[model samples]
Target: MAIAASTSSPVRMKRRSSAHYRLRRRVRKGALGVLILLVLAYTLFPYYWAIVSSTKQGAELYTTAFLPALNFSYYRQLFDNPVFMGSLLNSVFVATGTTVVSLALGIVSAYALGRLDFPQKRVVLMAILMISIFPQVAVLSGMFELINALGLYNRPSALIVTYLLSTVPFTTWILTTFIREFPRELEEAALIDGCSHFRILTRILLPLMGPSLASTGILAFILAWNEFLFALTFMLTDENKTVPVAIGLIGGTTRYEYPFGQIMAASVTVTLPLIIVVLIFQRRIVAGLTAGAVKG
Candidate 1:
């Protein structure tokens, strides 16, 4: 009887230890879930408030309402304004042009840097990196002088040219990393099939580069779309203004009244397109960024 009691005592202790571990794990998981919820709420609350504020009318803007009024008169007014509509168009054109040009130049530059052996290759890459790290203000004066000298000031082309300075370097750096991770065997296989360098790049590599391109292109588009400093400086007229500049210039009914509603409405209008793009390309963006993380 004594031996049996001792054995049963050990079994009870083992059961208690197992239950304690499970309880601790459950508490830990619950805490982690709560932390994630708080983080998400903090990050998304501002955008939600903006969206809610945009729908409010007149004195309603001053309220602390959590839900939107669902009134869209502010949006209607914004769309009716020709200057605002034109700025939206201008932003689209400039952003799209910058994305295409940057990607084109970056892809070729990346291919050379990644796949080929050349003298001063590392030096060239370092220079590109340095250019990317330079702030817009640091280059503003020189860029303005170049634009004025080329008679491109106040032109859409000026913004595109200046934007390329920032976007191209980023695209080149990212694409170079991605291209380097590609198997050399693919290029060699194409070579044996009598494929020219250009052919190999266009046919063999480009299809595989879709994910990277989508990721980089969307980022470049966002940068150009939201750029205000260059746009404000270079685009002098209402006719050439981008969305950022246009939104800033939105006026109140009188000197005493601020157009908070209109401003919030414009903000929502401009932000939605970017959010949609991100959602659409989210998968590609994830795949591109995580391409070389795992070996197998």
Candidate 2:
């Protein structure tokens, strides 16, 4: 009876330990789920509120309400305004141009930086990093002078050139990371096949880099699309203005009055494209960002 009791005591302790671990795991999962929900709500609530606020009209806009009246008249008004429509086109053109030019240059720069050995390579990369770290306001005056000197002021081309300052560095940095992780064997194989450097980059490396390119391209587009300081400073004319500047120019009946409804409408209109782009490339973005995190 003494031996049986001692053996049973150990069995009971083992069962209790197993149960405790299971309970702890369940609690941890529950807490993690709650945290995720809170994070999602925090991140997405502002966008949801924007959508709700956009539907409110006139006096309704000032009223506190979670659900909007589902009105879309402001969107119609936005479409009717030629200046606003023109700004949309201008933003698209500038953003697209910036992305294309930045990526085109970034890929070559990244290839050189990541794959080749050269003198002062580290210094060059450090310079690019420092340039990216500089705030837009810090360089605004010099950029303005450069734009003016180049005859690009008041033109979409100005925004493209200035945007390359930010976009190219970012793309190059990200692509460099991806290129560094790429197997060197493939490049050597291509070289042995009598392929030129350009041919190898285009035919071999470029295709394998779709995820990184899409991620960086979309980010560059968004940055250029939403840029306000440069857009406001460089593009003075309404016809040349981007969406951000045009939205700020939305007016009311009186000089002191602000059109909240129309402002929200324009905000929603301009933001939808970015949201769609993000959704479309969500997978690629995740893959690009996580590519070099693990090794076989």
Candidate 3:
């Protein structure tokens, strides 16, 4: 029985290593290709539908058409509306403000934490990380009260300040890690050449840190741009809405269904800048992340 079992196992193993096994492998490859296509369809169908839908006018929308209409009426209406355009400008202002402020504060803080050794530095870093992970909802009331107290209620600046709660910590954390990987010897060499610490960071480090900075900045911009809760809560007036809040302001048909054509057109419009920005700076993002505070 033992001899028979040993011989049978070898036969099975040989079968697995044979042309039959190759056929199974091909079958799996074909199955995987089909599965990938299905997933691609599932993921992309919405965008495709949006494109198709955006081309139709409100009247033409009741009857579904798989083929896109060349009508630009929805787009014209969107651009012609002052409220929508104002909201778009407001989003640009808030998002830009947040990015600038966060990066300004983050680089200095990150440099100190990353390079300058101090007492309880690790503790401080851990605290920053912990704060970054905290639920935004937990501090919603507190932030709202503070904004009101600061007399910034219903202002674009209020959103700018509040967004820091989300953007700054993460920015600092990433920048710190990247900075820490810098060569200590370079700083030493700069110091010996009578360069100030600030000069070293500005002239030597900042240029080298471009890719990471661009990546971090883009991420910050996206966060601020897409932020809905704070935009909705703070921007009370019709004139003060951002893209996300502005989209909600436009009502749907039958009080339940959204104006799909307009909404999708706005979506398409809003997403183009992000896609362009990312495509332009994507290469730098990878380089910056990998250019850590380490040297060979």
Candidate 4:
């Protein structure tokens, strides 16, 4: 009887210990979730404030606390502004052109680097990396001169070409990493089936790389859309200005007594497209980023 009691006592203690561990774990997990929520809120609060402020009227905007108050006048006024539409169109054109050009070149260069081995391959790649790492400010003077020589200053083409310099190298690096992960066996089998290199790449590899391409394209689009410096420098004319430059114009122009509402409205408008893009490509971006992190 004594032996049985001792054994049962140990079992009860073990059960209590397990319960305590589970409770602690649950508490820790709840705390972690709260921390994440706080971090997300902290990061997103500024954009949220912008959206709210944009919706308020000029009078209400200045008077109210940094919270949203629903008003339609601000939205209507923003559209009624002549330069708003033009700036939006310019942004669309530059972002689209930059994405298309960068993706086309990035895909070809990535494929070459991934599949073909040759002398000076490493050297060429190193050059690309070095150029990519160079600050945009460092090359601004040369780019400005080249744009002037080509008679593209203050033109959409100037912005397009300049944005390529920012997008291409990073796109190439990302796509090359993605391409290297493709199964060599598939390419070999395609060759065995008498498929040409172009056919294999176009028909087989490209389709498989859709996610990576989407992720890179989305990033390039965002960069081009949000770009301010080149747009400001090259597009001195209001007619050719992109959204960022347009926003700057609104902020600087003192024709209006108060411009905060208009500026905030423009900020909201410009940010909407980027938010939409992220929503569309969020999954692909996550997958592309995480694919190389873990070993199969």
- Give lDDT per model, in order: 0.94, 0.93, 0.89, 0.88
Q: For each candidate, what TM-score against the reference? A: 0.95, 0.97, 0.84, 0.93
For residue 254, what is the lDDT in candidate 3?
A: 75
| Candidate 3: C-alpha lDDT | 0.89
Best to worst by TM-score, what's the order? Answer: 2, 1, 4, 3
Candidates 2 and 4 compared: the better one by TM-score is 2
Q: Please, what are the lDDT tens digits per residue for candidate 3 over residues 13-70?
A: 8987897889999999999999999999998788888878889886777777789998
Which model scores highest in TM-score?
A: 2
- Which segments of candidate 1 are over 4 A away from where they belong? none
Error of 2 at 46 (Å): 1.2
Clashing residue pairs, candidate 3? 180-293, 181-292, 181-293, 181-294, 182-293
Against the true structure, candidate 4 reaches a TM-score of 0.93
Can you write out model 1's per-residue Cα lDDT over 123-239, one digit (the tens) per residue?
Answer: 999999999999999999999999999999999989999999999999999899889899999999999999988898899888999899999999999999999999999998999
Q: Looking at model 4, which ten-residue stretch has the lowest summed lDDT?
A: 249-258
Q: Work out candidate 3's RMSD over C-alphas.
A: 4.7
| Cα lDDT, model 2, residue 38 | 100
- Candidate 1 collision pairs: none
